[model samples]
Target: MESKIILITGATNGIGKAAAKELAKQGHTVIVHGRNKDKTLRVLEEIKAETGNANIDILLGDLFLLSDVKKMADDVKKKYQKLDVLINNAGGTMGKVREATDEGFEKTIVLNLLSPFLLTQSLLPLLSNAPSARIINVSSEMHKFGGKPFFHDFQLEKNYDSVRAYGLSKLYLIWISRHLSAELKPKNITVNTVHPGVSNTNFGLDADRGFFTNLVGKLLMRFSLTAEQGAASLIYLASSDDVEHVTGLYYGPKKKPAEPSDRYYSIENENRVWGYCSQIVAPYMDT
Candidate 1:
């Protein structure tokens, strides 16, 4: 495989960082993305030292802002002519209450779904230009258990809960991925989503659950995959020649199919979610 240009969001920690390290080890040019400058720099230095791969570059932007997402896409496009892989690996859950961005959209939705949607949209031309490109969305199992988000209350304006909202965002991501799979079929770009499995990331920053979360982490996640293990499927999809032309599919622990909640299997839902995403990011979409 030729040296591929890869963009991975939320690379400071967890699955994102793990994917970055592994991908770099494989000799791919990795664009490491993070919101925090200090953390990104530290991780970048470590990656370079560990992998001896200097091709890694850092892209920083607050994903909650569509303008930042657009600017980040522009920044990435400027640095690389061809984008062979786009991994939407950033995610977070807003605890307990509803939160909105400066633009009045829900925080979780903006970060997890809208940012990826717009970033992928803006980078389409570059990705399509590559002979073989892939878009890997990092999704979660919560989406299967999480309830459907209403079309009318798309942003959860009337009602809200942090975990539920996060799941809905993942659902939208899966939906969007499937739709892009169909739309980009004729292009060189491929799109698919992945489940990283219950990871021990710092996403659970809430100190209130320190006791229980720690216990759960020790019991359940300790034996489970580390960030590197969780990121295996993503690295496979990104650099492995095995999945050439693979697109619009959902993967679980071992690239196996995890029956998505019935709703996610519907093309109707995918179309509707895509419509909603386009409507949400219309103002900031790159022309």
Candidate 2:
């Protein structure tokens, strides 16, 4: 495989981390991103040691903040003139109750939806500079659960459930992927979303949840995929020539096109969500 520049967010854990290791092993210039500096560096070194590939690099930022997203983009642009692929793999579910970020958006929505929107928009210049670039978004099948957004209260302001909030965030991301695929098709940049399939990782454990919810989450683990198995689809999208031209589609572990939700395929809903997110991140779209 030819070497390419690849950036993966939330690479310090789970599927993102597994993908980063696989990419690095393939001799690509892998940039691993994480929230903490120490852990980020540790993961970088660990990947280097495990893969025996010294080309791995690190970028640190809190994806929940638009300002931090812009800062991370600026750093990437300063260092590299071209980015062959961008894996928007950094996202997670919030606790039982909804919490707002400093920016006023719900924490779940900000981390999963707005962060990727701003980061991708800001990095478009670099992504466009490459001969052919791909944007792989890590989304979930649960998107169908909350595909119908409460337009009147887009942020789940009135009523908040952690699972639904998570589904809503992933749904928005899949829509953004579809919208961007169309926008960037002329530029030779393919954008796609993948459902990593319930992986056995430290996902819901970090949240402050009730005993019952936690117990259910743990029980579900028995049917979950290992982190490495979960990352197969992501690795395929990022490195497979078979999917090089594939864009604006949802993929499952089978490496085939999968349906997101009947609601998400609606043109009206796509535009509505795009317009809403664009307006919210207007100030950060200067790039």
Query: Which of the numbered candidates is closest to the native, going by highest TM-score?
Result: 2
- What does candidate 2's lDDT look like per residue over 1-287, in tens digits? 88999999999999999999999999999999999999999999999999999999999899888888988998998999999999999998888888998888898888999999988988999998988999999999888886457777778999788888888889889988999999999999999999988889888888976789789888887799999988998899999888888889999876777887866468888898899989888887763
Q: Model 1 Cα displacement at 267 (Å)?
A: 2.9
What is the TM-score of candidate 1? 0.93
Residue 276's C-alpha lDDT in candidate 1? 86
Error of 2 at 218 (Å): 1.0
lDDT of 1 by residue, 91-147 (tens): 887766687999888988898899999999999889988998899998888896558
RMSD of each: 2.1, 1.2
Q: Highest lDDT: which candidate?
A: 2
The positional error of residue 53 in candidate 1, measured at the CA in angstroms, is: 0.8
lDDT of each: 0.84, 0.89
